[model samples]
Target chain A: MSMVEKKLSTKTQVILTLLFILGMALLLWWADKGFDSYKQRVLRLIGIYAIMAVSLNLINGITGIFSLGHAGFILIGAYTAAILTLTPSEKAMSYLFGIQPWIKNLHADFFTATLAGGFMAALAAFLIGWPVLRLTGDYLAIASLGFAEIVRIWANNALTITNGPLGLKAIPEYSNIWWVYGWLLFTVVFIASLVYSSYGRALKAIRESRIAAESMGINVFKHQLMSFVVGAFFAGISGSLYAHWLTTVDPRITTMGPMLTFYVLIMIVLGGLGSITGSLIGAAIFAILFEWLRDLEQPFNFFGITVPGIPGIRILVISALFIAVMIFWQRGIMGREELTWNNLYKWLFARRKEGEKS
Target chain B: MNQEVFFLQNFFNALMLGGLYALIAVGYTMVYGILRLINFAHGDIMMMGVYFAFYTAVLFSSPPLIAAIVAVAGAAGLGFLIDRIAYKPLRNAPRISALITAIGMSFFLESFAVVVFGAVQKPFVQIFKTKESKVILNKVLMVGGARIPLLTFLVILLTLAIFAVLFLIVYKSKIGMAMRAISMDIPTTALMGINVDGVIGFTFALGSALAAASGIMWAMRYPNVYPYMGFMPGMKAFIAAVVGGIGSIPGAVVGGLLLGFIEIFTVSYFPTMSGYRDAFSFIILILILMFKPSGILGKKAIEKV
Candidate 1:
């Protein structure tokens, strides 16, 4: 609490943040040089998911808004990016039903397309949030889920623009470790800063007591809508990253049937609902586990015994893990605590000091 | 088919669909009424019921009525087990945690079904395939010079009978009184010497039994049993519960019937919009939440804050 200690702490934080950035850059370089195609793909996915999980945490965890329409925003971003980035000839080949004449000749570079995609998603979020954000709690969850379903149905039937489930193929592969990690870094810093700001305090106030927050002159609806739109914007960016990385986009990917939103939900819940550090760790754990669990679906031999592959066993295991986490570790791994140097120091060495003080 | 016949046939189909939805919606309403948690796995329980009936009839060569009974009983057991294992421990936790657990339970049951019963669709055995049963199901009646299948009448009658029985049990029986008391306040109910947990278990069991019946009836009409079969209907039924005012049994039935009519009429009148039929219920859900969050039959609870 002394001035000298405060200055020392700030200095340590700056040094630690710089070191972390350097470490990440080194990892990206090493990955570019050393990792196999599969490892690189997984690493890229971790970055994309980190962005997604953190953004979702901003809305669901920090703001206490139970919005489940993430897939709708992601779909808009994916389709926008895919449509814009596709070469005119590629568009012709993919749009079997027929391409719209106005957008037929349009094309953009990867960066421009991705930004446009994010903008479109944010715009959509703002419009939808105006009406949907009026609801609360479980009603909000179901209504948002319905909105996602409606988006999927629209994508499935809109032949001229979306190709009506035929889906776009051969999108240029423009996402890599640098792109994903860069976005991940931006998302974490931006959201963390936002969380630490006055607006972020207002959101937490609304979460804890809406009536009290309103009495304090906080515009609950406007703040909730802002958090939703911002979260949706990042989700859009992540979707663009995902689409460009895979080189394909489809309506099925955005539908609730595929369970993509559930996976994101599991990550946030597992990582710690309201912690940025938890979202990062949760995203990493989920991406790795998802890839590793494929072994459960593939036939493997153990001690000269042939075990038959069970195709759906992986999902079953994951679902069981989710239920177990909810039941036993309801606060999740982070429990509203962030992984900072000061906290780490306290956990390691300051316990004795605290005990003596007490 | 002539225009009149087409209209009549679709109208009858809507009635049957409504009956099926009502059956499932009642289960959702009952469970939500007691627990204040949406049992997401309710749909998968219906799927389990369909599979249970199919396996019992095929494996044991049991009579159709016996298979139906076994299926309903099995579904009730599963629901009871799910409540005990999943929802019971979280009774005092935040409602959001319980909701998340419900979603996880839903995912677990669905994926478990896929693993146990393969992902492929199986042709459901027609209970009415026998000559004697067909005579009853195939018996048609002329209404305004249009022939209506007797099976449609059977489904509607079955749904009504079940609802009537459920109504009597809930209104006239002591157990139903316990259920109502628990829904109002679990602690008070427990303090008053009513076994709150037992009533909740009974409510879950009853809901599961109804879901089973709806699943079997659905398979009888459509004749396709798959692991994911219950999802769409289950979601529609939940929407019905919400539309009808979530905790009210009568509201659920009305919502289900209204939804069925909307779905069927959308398809019949606007053929091109058939693919968008599923979206209609969700649109209605949003509208209902916007204008009447308490639903048609639900009593609104004032927020404490």
Candidate 2:
């Protein structure tokens, strides 16, 4: 009976997976054809945010590293991709303080530039993780935060490279739905598989207890560094998408501060930490809600009641809501539970049986 | 002679700043000592304290002494409430949950401030208005060729007094003993018939009060009240706490003073590199983390299975 149950479930799982892909494909086709530019932009942003959310989850959630340096990695990725993709004329126009001569001549297609961005960010994560992964918990968090701060400060001073505070402009708007969603899909699938693999189990073991994992002969440092580097690579990819989407980059602390890290952290937390599907869902909800929250900025009618607008209302609401979630509903939409095909099949079967009984 | 005066002037300025930083750093260290939680909202609480003082003196037309007291008291109340509301629930939860809540609370306070107090910078001035548009800022003293403000001496003296009182509390008082014991081992301390929750809340109050005092002094020196005013000083003070060995009061003071001295002297000596001054703290933080993660005065903890 158990063997028959397993075979039937596997068949249902494949069907569910195919259905999910078909639905997503339909939505993407609609997004390309039917949505206006504003709606399209939001869709692109959600995809990019999903990428960021899942990648960060790989480090902070699965690996349990509690790193706060995603912004620094993002910065590396953004600058690298932006610089590589910028035409010589565009670089000349943006670099008022004068451009780095070699970089001024450098140019690449969006694909190559994005890969370079990921590589550069991965490299930075490797260097930073070497000394940084040695620390644990809050110390690691602060050290990583310090790393981001240092990066921001460097960008602020590196006039020839980053163009200082002026930042870059008119580099080209190369990010679109296909590119953004494509990378996001790859990230989700890659991370989902990675989380279920033997190596991923080692990460979970490390997360649960470092000493225990070490005693069990798991190389704690190596696995953590690997996750950190991989997480950073996707972070860089997302940053590349973000830069091309926005067509601008700056070295402001507000942009690369622990605040952005917190935003990503909450996304994974809200989605349910250690759940890849949760990250995706959380990112979608966060991005859409944040965009929708702009209504709080000006007077608007809600169900025929006119509510006066308040400045900073969007940020205020998000922060307050974040606290309430942290306090009351920490498990979020999911609690380290993945929304897998098996679960979907079970839910559908349960509902059908209930309908027949009724 | 001019160069010597310049150095002395910067030295005095940095000393005063350091004193204020030490006051705030003590708040961070004390809370950390008790809770093993970083209390990320601490700096934002300081910002709120400044706002409290600003509103009281400006809107309520209160006396300077009354405003100062109100600020400190208000900050303490907020700290106690935050512990009650945010950190208390997560007492048994994972440390990461508590840390995330801390981060959330910090953002909540900052966003709340921005919404209530407008995002633009407001003038934070002397509560005691005189003929000049300045309070203590108007007064200056000359010792040798070096010019020093009276406020600098007052800040240093006040910091010293506060530190002495703090030392007395932690070392000589029963409650302080309780705090130290809890930091060493909370469960055992609780088992000893002590109210752990009450003690932790009280610790928050004391730390936040000190931060409020520092915030008031900081605003007096900077002469601006903004929603984000507490960020830089708060971050620097947290670094100061870590630098001195997070839970050590004396370590906080030493770290704050040393940081202030290094930061100011570097800028004074290298005007061309003043733009990079903020980077110094982060550099020091990384270096400290890499070489001596336990910090200058912090003892290393043993990991248990």
Candidate 3:
């Protein structure tokens, strides 16, 4: 309450903020300059996927709903963005079931296209989630999965825009590590802010006990829809980034079935639910581990001991690790706790006794 | 335009397909009736059965009957193990946890199969070589001159026999009574000194055996057996279970037959819309879940306020 105390608090907050910003800035600089092209691309991929995994946490973690259909939203965003950003010349040269003559001449840049795609995905979620979110538990999970499959099937059949099974090719590669990291920061900050707000509390309450929350006069269905839509919006954005980054989009990319959804859910579950920091850490760890394991197929001779087809071995090991982690270390790394400055500060200073508890 | 003949063929095909679907669906419905969990790995278990049968056939160069016996045994073992490992530990856990574990088990088994089977597509050759025979029903007034296949009739007969056996087991035996009691109230059944785990395991084994039988029949009809083939059919059968009133044995059979007819007829009549087959089933599932979660034959279960 004293003036000096208030000043000290303000200065501490500013210093913490500056330190966090400087660390992220350093990471971005390193990615942009110091890393090789492949490493840079991997970092970019991680940034985008981290946004996706964390955004998905809003629904699966905060909302406590099992949705196996995040990929469908991503597909919607990717296609929408791809169509919006396709060059006029490209549209003219090749027609997908014949694009409208008027729209053929228009093209939006990557930024606008990504936003537009994400918006469309949000709209789709709003429409679908209203009716579909009523179901509880596994029924909801399968229904959402069914919805994703429906989207994929429709996309495959809708030749006019989707180009059928052939998929959209030659998409512009406008996504870079800087852009990806910028979006990643945007997603993390946005989600963290939302989770700290009253709405986030209501959502978390709904997740913990839907019936009890409903009894307490929380509009459970509305919150579920809101969380689902928000989560879906970022998934769509990530999808847009994926489309632009890969420069190609196919229906099969989404069809890997429950595997993709399973991995995302595993990531969130392995990272404690209802924890934003957990989502970030889990995503980073999983993406890096998965990529590193994928590279194991290449023979890496360690002291003349030749190892071959290491990727296959990596999968077996990772799966065993997953089983072990799920069985023993459930609640993942964070256990629903945020890795915030206060915790670090507390840990760093040790116990200052009752007088310095604050 | 031989409408009658085309209709007959479609009807027969649908009925046969539905019978097989019903065979698989009963297991899903039974498990769900007691456990209230969707056993996502059920489909993969069916695939495992087919693979087992395929391996058995290759091993002994035996007839179809012997191969089927081996497949059923393999499926039963897996079903028992799945219950013991995944479902047993999570009996008191949240429903979603079990479902997630089921998904994990599904992934584990499928991936294991992929690694074991080398992820290659395998064709299932019917060991029972049934030659197609043309049957003239009222030959004078040939309805589009369509001849019903002998195998279709055999499928219908086999379906009836199996269901009769199932009905007898479910209705006439002590286990059936216990299964019914458990479905109604687990706590009460446990108080009555019933071995819930054993009953559940048996139910899983029985269901799995049925699924394996259906898988073999399905492979014979389709002639293509791949590791991933069970996913779509399993989904379809699950939908059928939902539509038919998931806990009712008769309901599952009815649902399966109806779904099969709908799919076959729709695909045949509207070839262009054939690609939407899976979508159509999913939409049906969503509609059922939204409007009639209890299903056609299912009793409405309520939670205490």
Candidate 4:
């Protein structure tokens, strides 16, 4: 609490943050140039998942908005990016059912497509947020879920724009470690900064008590809508990364449904809903566990006997863990506490004082 | 077939489908009415019911009647256990926590089905029907030039019979009264010496049984069973419950039938739009939520804050 300690903490925080960024740069370089194809892919997926969990945290965790329509927005982003970035010939191959001439001829670079995707999803959130945000609690959740389902069903039926369930194939693989991690870092800083600013405090107040926030002159709807749009923008960016990483855009239920939203939900809940670093940690753990669980579906050796693979046993285990966490450890890893330099400094100072006493 | 007959046939199909949905919707409306939990696993529980029946008849070579009885009882028990295990611990927790748990329970049942029952589709015929003997269920009825199956009428009549019994139990039974009290005010109901948990468990059991009955009938109409079979119907039924106005029993049935009519009529009128059948229901759901958030029959709920 002393002034000198505060000054030291501020300086240390800046230096540590710079070092951390540098460390990440080094790690990214190693992963991109040194790691194998599979490792790179996993790394990319981890980055994308972090983006989703952190952004989702802003709305569901920070702002207390239970929106399940992120998957729908992701679908929008993915389809938009896929359409914009696909070459005319690639579009021709996928649209065996026929396509609108403008979309067929449409083409853009990966960055432009991703930006367009994010903007499109943001636009959608703005349009729907007015009506959907008015419903509180479970009504909001269900109505948003309905929106996602409607998007999914329409995507499957809209032959001209979405390629009608055949989905776009031959998407460019542009989501390398650089792009994925770059966007993830930006997302973390953007959301964390917003969470700590005056706006962030206002958002938290709205979450605690909307009426109180309104009484304090905080525009509850505007803030909720902002968080929703921003969260959706990040989700859209992640969707673009996901599409480019997978090199396809099938908008199937498994890929873009309540299940996908649930996966992100689980990540945020596990990471401690309100913590940015918590979500990042949660995403990392989840990404690794999900990939590892795939082995459960492949034949494995036991102590004495070879056990046959169980296809869905992995999801069963994860889902079980989700319930257990909800029942036993609901605060998650962070519990609204962030891992920061000030806390670090205080811990070190207390340690020195204890050493002197000992 | 003539145009009139085709229309008649589709109408009958809609009626049967609507009846089946009504059966499922009752389960959802009852549970949501009381616990304020969406019971996301309701559909999966119905799916489990079909599997329970499928196994009972297939593995044990039991009669269809026995399979049906076992399925209803099994689903009731599962529903009860789901409450005891998952929802009970979180009764006093935040509503959001309960909601997350509900979604998790849904995934648990689904993956459990996939791992245990296997993902492949299985034939869902009634037990002991020999190939040569035409079962009464398989027999078709011709009325006004429309060839309708006897099962169609059976499904509709069976739904009505169940609804009448459900009405009696809900409006007349002690447990039903307890359920009604709990829904109105859980804390007050508890204060008044009603065993709120027991009522909730009973509500879940009753709802699960209804879902099972509908699942069994749904299987007969569709004639194939898979682990994921209940999901679509389960979702549609909830929407049906909402359309009729959630938390209202009569509203659920009316909503189910209305939704069924919309789905069938939409498909019949525009065959090209058949793939978008699911979308129409959701479109209707969104519009309903926007215009009349309480649903057609639901009372207007005043926001507390």
Candidate 5:
């Protein structure tokens, strides 16, 4: 009976995988054709966030590294891609504080600029990871948070490079649904494959018990560093995509002050840590809800009462929601389980069967 | 001012700032010692304390001293309430859950403050303000043509007094012994028939009272109170706690002073790099964690396999 079930599940998995791809493609196509520019922007944001959430899951979920430095990597990638892709005229216009001559002369096409951005971010992660990954638990969290703030400070003061917080503008809006979704698809596939491989197993082992994994001959530090670098690489790609999409990149946008890192953390936590499908769903829900919550910030008539706009209520609501979720459902929506067809089938039929037997 | 005067003045300023940080750092160190959880909302509790003082004194027309008393008491009460509501239930849950709840609570408090108090920076009624501006406000002693503000002297004195009181409480008191035991091993301490929950509540109350006192003093010094004002200082104080050896009380004070000196000296010497002053704490934090994870006063723990 178990053999038959396994075979049936394998066949079902193939069909479900194809269906999922087809559904996503159709959704993207419909969004591009049917939605307004504002709605389309939201869709694009969802895709970029999917990439970010998945990448962060690689570090925080799969590897159990509590890094709060996603904003720093995002800053690096955004600046790298923006500087590389900006036309000389655009650069001259944006850099009011005397552009660096070396950077001014350099420009690349969109694709190369993005790849280079990812590479630079990965390189930074590699260098920082060596010393940082040594620290564990809350210490690691605080240290990484500090690193992100340091990055923001650098961006604000490094006048020649980051334009001294005036920020980059008109960086050529080249990102669209296609670029975002393509990268999102690539990130999901890459991370899913990595999470199923031997290295991924090693990461999970380390997460469960560091000493045990070490005794089992698993190179704990090496696997952790690998996860950190890979996670940073994809985060960099997402940042590049985001920068191009917005046509603007600012130091404040990448700072902890704006709570960008917090939002990403919320996404992964709410979706369910250690689950790839959860990350995707969490990102989608976050993007949509974030946009939807803007209504709460604006003035609206309720029962003929003209309520005034409450400027910061959006974050207030989200933060409250985050607390509620943490207290009531600590394991989050997905828990450690994936949202696959086989799991769904087992949950639906097998659990009921067991209940009946009992 | 001459170079000598400038240096002396900055040094004095650093001392006062260090004292303020130490006061706040004590709260972080104590709670962390007992709970082994970073109460992310501790800073916001400080903010609440400041606002409480502001409303009591300015809005209700109470005296500054009375306001300070009420605010500190209120903060202690809020701390107890927070532990009972947000943290107590999660005592046996994963540490991450409690940490996240703390972060969420921090956000909730800040947002709630913004909604209630409005997001604008309000001018705190200066407790030190006097009718004769120059004689009292700028009252300073000249030593070799270097002037020292009286307020700085007062702040340091107050910090020292607070520290002495805290030291006496922690070392000489029976409850303090219970706190130490609980920090070492909660289960064993409970098994020994101590009221662990009440002791934990008292710990929160004591730590929060210190934070409140610091917050009121901070408002008096800075002359403004806003919802988000506690974030940077709170973060710095937490860093101080870690630097001093997170679970050690005296370690926190030393760490706070070191951080204060580093910040002030860096600004005085490298004026152009003053913008990067905030980054210095983080750099120091990372260095300390990497080289000495146990910190200056923290004992290294061995994990059981």
Candidate 6:
């Protein structure tokens, strides 16, 4: 508690922090220029997907709740961004009643559109979460899923905002590597800090045992709701990123029911639950695997013989892989352990240890 | 000679729709009654049943009775096997685990079917397509002159038959007593030397059979059969199960009938509000959970913590 000791500790901490930042900056700077446009696209996609996976971790991993409604938040975010950023020409033509005069031509930039989408999604989540979050376990899951369906239906019918089922197309592609990674870095640091703080500890406590947490002076509903809202906010941001990246937004694009959510869940589960590192690695692997498998959708030749129906073959193979992963690697690759320096070292040194043992 | 007939017709249409819903609702109710988990894949199972019926009909090509029997049996077998292999082992895991598994199985089945059946919509031709018949009522019943199809009457008859069979099995038979005993307290029934697994398996079989039958009936009404057809009805049936007291047999029937009417009336009265068809049921569910978690006619059980 002495002033001199505190000052020394602060200086040491600052030195370590500077070194860490410098290291990361050097790595990103090096990777940025070397990465081609396509590689940059992949990185941006990873960043957006990482945001989604991390936000979902709040619900499924941290909270021990299975929610199939993450896509619902994404849908809200997409539509919100579309409405906010589209030009007056688009607004005037799309709107049968015509756009509001003041905000008609109001086209916000990428960040503002993303923020608008996130906040709007957060607002929607707050409204829906209040009642539905009360139910626990499967009841909560089904109720949330139903709520997502309702949001989709509302989006489909609300032509004034969403352009009905035809969907909003011709969105600007503004989600580059920098913006995507910027948001990802913000979310990662924010959530990681939150998890390490007292509030994060309390959230973990609530997840461990709601009744016990309630008895121990934690407000279960409030904490759960907060997590839901924050998680949904990040999901919304990811949604906006997706919209900008694909240059299109459609209610129908996100209307595949639990399929997208299921894939995301599988990624997190396969990576390892309750681990941010797992989610990041899992999302990257998933995106790459998906892209690789997409090639199977085309006709190919094996030793000069032509193959037929490659897309159909790919679905069966992927589904089978999903089932195998579920049955065999239940704890996933990371097994709830973070990819911290020590863990990574241990993983890398596994061969040495095995040799010593031999 | 008035609009009264149309009202009667719509009313009858609603009733028939309710009957079909009740058929699927029973499966959801029974499974939930025993397991206390929503089988997210139940709808996809019903999809399998429809496909089974379709293929069986194609195979027999004569005697609708034989084809129906074969399809129902095939569906029942598939349901039984799915329960034995996928669900029974995971009975003791966290409800979420089972739920995820259900979702996985649903994906597996739907994708598998899609691979085999293709993604195109196929029309389901009834073994015997009946022409519309006029129902003569003493009073002039009409809802803007919507005609009451005689097939609606057949559905009513089928619904009555299903209820009668379910009632006799659940209340009047020894196996029914065992089922009720297990539902009330599985351990106690097991302690009393009743085979719990057998009863559970039988429950699944019964429910799956009902689902298969309902799938056929639904295909009859809707006529189009696709790999993903069971999803909407499955969801509505789950909602109905929740609305009607989940574990209560009679509740499923009532819930189905109520949901059918709600969908019909909502579509008929306010076509613009038709998009809210599914939303209304979910809202009802939320309200029911908030106000009365046990649902209509469901008995509340206090947990002894």
For candidate 5, write residues A246-280 as lDDT tens digits: 88888873242337778888899899989998988
- Local distance difference test values of all predictions, in order: 0.88, 0.88, 0.81, 0.89, 0.87, 0.77
lDDT of 2 by residue, A1-358 (tens): 1323322466777787889888998999988999999999999999988999999999999999999899988888999999999989888887999887988999999999999999999999999998899989998988898888888888888899999888887768899888998898889888878888999999999998999999999999999999999999999999899899989888875675667787888798889888889999999999999899988888999899998888887778888888889888998887787887665655567344334322
Query: Over the stretch A44-152, how does candidate 6's per-residue lDDT look in tens digits?
Result: 7877888989989887888766677888898888877877777878777766644446656678877999999899889988998888888887778878888888888
TM-score of chain B of 1: 0.96
TM-score of each: 0.96, 0.95, 0.91, 0.96, 0.95, 0.89
Model 1 residue runs over 4 Å out of place are: A1-8, A253-258, A352-358, B1-5, B126-129, B133-141
Candidate 4 residue-wise lDDT, A1-358, digit = tens? 3334432556678899999899989988987899889988999999999999998999999999999898988888888998988899878887888889878898999989999999998998998898899888887888888888888888888988898778888888999888998899889889999999998999999989999999999999999999999999999999898899888877577888878898999999999988888899999999999999998899998787899999999889999999999999999998887878766666666444433321
Winner on lDDT between 2 and 6 is 2
- Against the native chain B, each candidate's TM-score is 0.96, 0.97, 0.93, 0.97, 0.95, 0.91
Give the higher-TM-score candidate: 4 or 5: 4
lDDT, candidate 3, at A156: 82
Which lDDT value does model 1 have at A18?
92
Write out the backbone clash pairs for model 6. B3-B142, B4-B140, B4-B141, B4-B142, B5-B141, B5-B142, B6-B142, B6-B143, B7-B142, B7-B143
DockQ of candidate 2, scored on C-alphas against the true complex (2 decimals)? 0.77
Fold similarity of candidate 3's chain A to the true chain A, as a TM-score: 0.89
Off by over 4 Å in 5: A1-12, A253-258, A348-351, A355-358, B1-3, B125-138
lDDT of 1 by residue, B267-302 (tens): 998999987888999999999998999999999979
Q: Across all candidates, what is each one's fraction of true contacts kept?
A: 0.72, 0.75, 0.42, 0.76, 0.79, 0.44
Could you give the candidate ranking by DockQ, starting with the highest?
Answer: 1, 5, 2, 4, 6, 3
Over B1-305, each residue of candidate 2 has an lDDT whose tens digit, in order, gives 68889988998988988888899999889888877889989999999999999899988888777999999999999999999999999999888888889988888898899889998898787475655436467688996788788878878888889889989998999999999999899999999999999999999999999999999888888889888888788889999989989999889998999889989999989997888888898788888888988789998877776
What residue runs in model 6 are displaced by over 4 Å at the alpha carbon? A1-42, A93-103, A253-256, A301-305, A310-319, A345-358, B1-3, B126-146
Q: What tens-digit string does per-residue lDDT give for candidate 1 at A306-340?
A: 88888888789999999999999988899788998
| Cα misplacement distance, residue A326 of candidate 1 (Å) | 0.5
DockQ of 1: 0.82
Query: Residue B118 deviation, candidate 6, in Å?
Result: 0.8
